[model samples]
Target: MTSNAENELLERYGWPIEEMDFGREDDPDVIGCAVLEEVEGGTSGIFVVRPGLDEENRTGFAEWAVQRVGRYFEHGPEPDGWQKRSDGGWQLWVRRVEMPPI
Candidate 1:
């Protein structure tokens, strides 16, 4: 189940369904993290990162989070693109593994 805020975003952004909690960063400035897995037909996962402070633009928090995930997780997805949310957060798309056809 998604939070009310998330639900609003889902409607507003037309995001893909089926999101998973990928966990948060240890950085004190970052919070409310999750990953929308297998987006775009399993080609990518989207990183949802909420910062503790108010950010006006793409302040590299998404990139920093991506780097952190890469260092902690083995063979993590690579960053494809990102966007600053209206609520002062960020959503980053990362490349995911491709599955074989059935």
Candidate 2:
């Protein structure tokens, strides 16, 4: 609902639940990914938890869908390869890009 609430949820993971379809960037597919369609409210969304890097100040992607779902509360949804599934669900794939060898 509110950003504070969202932040509170993300505080533990460090993955910013970036709004889905908020913006588009030049990137490729990632290695790991996750898609979450709320089992209750029916609010569908997606996010990625990388192993080396996460949302803001962390490293790694969620190892499970159930865990990834808890990474909710984003201002909107995920970014990049996040897509809408046939079941009206959401899907997020890791972006495939080299971070300039950083």
Best by lDDT: 2
Candidate 2 TM-score versus the reference = 0.37
Candidate 1, run of 10 with poorest lDDT: 51-60
Model 1: number of backbone collisions: 0
Which tens-of-lDDT digit does each residue in 8-67 have in candidate 1? 444544532332344444443343343434334432334454433234212243444435
Residue 21 local lDDT, model 1: 40
CA lDDT of 11 in candidate 2?
64
lDDT of 2 by residue, 1-102 (tens): 324534543564444544333223444244455565555845544454434443432223333333445544443345333466788566766544547764
